[model samples]
Target chain A: MKDVYKSSMLYDFYGELLTEHQKEIYEDFILNDYSLGEIAQERGISRQGVHDMVKRCDRILNGYEEKLHLVERFSKTKEDVRRICQLADSDINQKNISEIKMIAQEILDNY
Target chain B: MKDVYKSSMLYDFYGELLTEHQKEIYEDFILNDYSLGEIAQERGISRQGVHDMVKRCDRILNGYEEKLHLVERFSKTKEDVRRICQLADSDINQKNISEIKMIAQEILDNY
Candidate 1:
């Protein structure tokens, strides 16, 4: 995924946990496509301060993702569901049903 | 589920993100079944302090679950997978396959 897109997705998932100040700066810089100098001027902080805050936000968001893995599991579950759909579209067979059950069990086991 | 079991599940999922002090105190009080006074004396803190800390930890962990819904989704997904397994165990037919596919699609849509 693109850097900004990934950041935004992380932000969407975990942004509420961030402080109000961090949220404002992160939105302006990453989501709104504002320049460092522009956000710095608006927030009455130095450009380096704004830059540091954005980097800190990224680290914090990534840290949450690493620990929680909610996003990762979601992607994997979606893929598994898609695979099940494909299996279902094929000819109905006992083996096919077994495979579907196996996939579902895998999904359950993962949690 | 039992209170301790539920707390342990939350701790297992999100406890590592907590401070070391929080983890130790929580493990003692919740997992080891230590009383507030016992924990407080062990840590050289007041019973009220230990009680406050445990309550705070509960709030924090519950807050994380509220926002992220990882635990909630895990339970729901497990139930869905069990439903899929049951559907699979029935007679193999077009209706059964369609139901399986529909369940899979529901899982995908949820994510």
Candidate 2:
């Protein structure tokens, strides 16, 4: 379940960068939860072929994440925004306001 | 100048998805401001080839932005963060604090 979640998130972030065929097969295997044999029969390819393509697509998506870290940065920014919301909810004071400003600036700086 | 800025931002966000050769040529043309003829001479390719590559890179980057809107989202989130900072800098009140929370939630929601 965790692997599925991570694959979906990675696909959400980088699937567009994949080739058309890769996208179709990967969407089936990962997003649609199609079995390898199912995808193979549907695409008129061997199960091994489907498996290799899925692996290649996973590698490609992971490579993009490794290089760009878009997903990582996004997760960090979301956490920071949550922190800001928490600070805002706590107390309306000078220190909390300053902390909010600091966090907001960090988000702007692509934290 | 404006085009350069936009190009750099797009490239910064999506360039890692491009091939290494495309990255090199694109960095030269868009980021380094290298002329097509110069790039062609340096790369031992025709000026037309260099032009086409740069244009293709632009299209690819723009397509990613069009599909994913990462760069657009980043800009919007940055603006929201700036607003949060401004609100924090101004008078501290219940209304302003709530506004900050709203904006922070907006950021968290991937605005």
Candidate 3:
């Protein structure tokens, strides 16, 4: 589930690289959750065409992911941030909030 | 900037949607840091072709970003994770570690 979210976010970030046909099909199939048949009907293409396009697009998305590992990096960064936030919110720690703030600042600085 | 990182991650995630030509240009321009002229020379295309392709790809990437805001969400999640980790690390906080764990679990649950 998280992977899907991460992938979607990645998709949002790089979707413009797609051709028009690829974008239309992806928007319908992935983003809109339209079925193959539904997308085929909407686009006036065969269900096979829709399926092939979706699969091709998926391969392209996954290819970039495999090579770059951007989502994984983002996920790690997110985990780091979450840990710091929890520290800040904890009542047991007062001084730690400053530390957490520093960490957050560091992340932001690198960001 | 974090935005650039986020965008890069997103690009990595969704880059497969691009056509082969688009991917080649993108890999060169964005990932490989080749200038438009360099990319054009390498691809044996005009500099204008390289420039136009890069701009078009940027638009497509930004378009998905505008609609989905995946990188933004990922960034927020990362911040939350960092906070939680800081809480766990603090010596002043003993019980807060458990709270931090809970938050991490919650994020994971939803993740």
Candidate 4:
């Protein structure tokens, strides 16, 4: 259901590793929301050809994320930061707040 | 310089992506410090074969790091944390300590 969203995130993390042509086509489809027909015309390829290339790029990016897990770990760290921020702003005890802040800071420092 | 050390660090970041064969051979060479001839005998391959495979693994791991820079960024963040700890311990102003802590915390959270 969210293949495109996940692909784009993976692209953001590993797009530099892709070939130049792959970047252009992937960006057009994922970032620019270009239709397959439009990409085909722009790249001087058939619509089916464009689709295949896009699929190839998807596999490439997904493989990188599978090995790296950069996005998943990043999301978890972000959630931790959010929780710490909320705790800091709440009417919590001062000692508890500092303890929570220290833990959150440690999580970030480790990453 | 320090190719073995660098290779081991890269392996720590991306070794899971390699094939089973690659993992075994690479571990023997880099982690176990086995000689090329020893790995070749243990794996039932030639010395030259072991050498080539180890070199290939190096290239593959280095390629991943080049694109992701996970280790480079991790090292930088670690340095920031070190500075924060040092500043906190030093006879610095409380205002300066909190400011440095906030900046370092932000860097970790973003990462």
Which prediction has the highest TM-score against the true structure?
Answer: 2
Candidate 4 lDDT, A1-111, residue by residue in tens = 337777877887788888999899989999899999999998899999989888999898888778877678665655654554454444445453455446555764555
Write the candidate numbers in order of decreasing lDDT: 2, 1, 4, 3
Q: Estimate, for each residue in B43-93, the C-alpha lDDT of model 2 and write its tens digit.
A: 999999998998899999898898878888778887888899899999999
In candidate 4 chain B, what residue range of length 10 has the lowest lDDT sum?
Answer: B85-94
lDDT tens readout by residue for model 2, A1-111: 327877887898888888899999999999899999999999899999999999899899898889888888878888888999999999678999999998888877762
Error of 4 at A46 (Å): 3.8
**Leading candidate by lDDT:** 2
Candidate 2: where are CA atoms >4 Å away?
Answer: A18-56, B34-50
**Scoring model 3 with DockQ, what do you get?**
0.14
Error of 1 at A52 (Å): 4.9
Candidate 3's residue-wise lDDT over B1-111, tens digit each? 124454466676556556788888887877777788888888899999888887787777776567656567666656765665465456555576566656656655554
* lDDT agreement of model 2 with the native: 0.88
True contacts kept of each: 0.82, 0.87, 0.15, 0.11
Candidate ranking (TM-score, best to worst)? 2, 1, 4, 3
Mind giving the per-residue lDDT tens digits that candidate 1 earns over B24-88? Answer: 99999999999898999999999999988998999889888887767777678778778888888
Measured with C-alpha atoms, the lDDT of residue A23 in candidate 1 is 95
Model 4 collision count: 0
List of chain B TM-scores, one per candidate? 0.73, 0.83, 0.75, 0.81
For all candidates, state DockQ relative to the true structure: 0.66, 0.62, 0.14, 0.21
- Model 2's DockQ? 0.62
- Better TM-score candidate (3, 4): 4
lDDT, model 1, position A57: 96
What local distance difference test score does each model get?
0.85, 0.88, 0.67, 0.74
